[model samples]
Target: MEKTFLELISENQSILFKICNVYFREKVDKEDYHQELIIQLWKAFPDFKNTAKFSTWMYRVCINAAIDILRKDKKEIKKLVFQKSTYIIYLIMGLSPLEIRKDCLN
Candidate 1:
């Protein structure tokens, strides 16, 4: 299982590079981010249900990991930006705008 996972990851590894490039501007950060992404993939691999394409699943995991890292690294700015975007998503999904704003602010 580990070998197969590693092979699949290697094939789709470009996803990692693209995410790190986008979310990590510094070379050092990119290296760190790449390692974290691989860790996340390994942790989540066993739970993969195989309902989706491997690359698509890889994208979801990597993107989520990248966002998680950014959220931690840029707490204040990321919260504001992410909250506003999440607020819009909630609105589109029929959630009350007031509730969304209150939740985002808090």
Candidate 2:
């Protein structure tokens, strides 16, 4: 199974690189996303029925994985920014951490 996957990926490796290039600007991000695409493809291999071309299946899997990663990162960044802004507001309001927690619950 591994050998077959390797051969197919080797032939279409450029597809993964192309998708990564389209999504990421930094070299490290591209490389990391490339690995993520490969892992996603491997995990989804069992579902491949050979009804469609390997490249087609690979493109779908890689694109979805890339989008998911971006969405997760965006969520984390937004959360961090919100926390920082909340802390600043709390400080200006002279609220303690416990008060901040209670306010958040409310």
Write candidate 1's Cα lDDT for 1-106 as tens digits.
9999999998998899999998899999999889999999999999888889999999999999999998888887877898788878899888797887777688
lDDT of 2 by residue, 22-86 (tens): 98889999999899889999999989889999999999989999999999989999999999998
**Per-candidate clash tally:** 0, 0
Instruction: Output the number of the lDDT-best candidate.
Output: 2
Could you tell me which residue pairs clash in candidate 2?
none
Quote each prediction's TM-score.
0.69, 0.81
Q: What's the lDDT for candidate 1?
A: 0.90
- Each model's lDDT comes to 0.90, 0.93
When summed lDDT is taken over every stretch of 10 residues in candidate 2, the lowest stretch is 95-104
Pairs clashing within candidate 1: none
Q: Model 1 misses residue 102 by how many Å?
A: 39
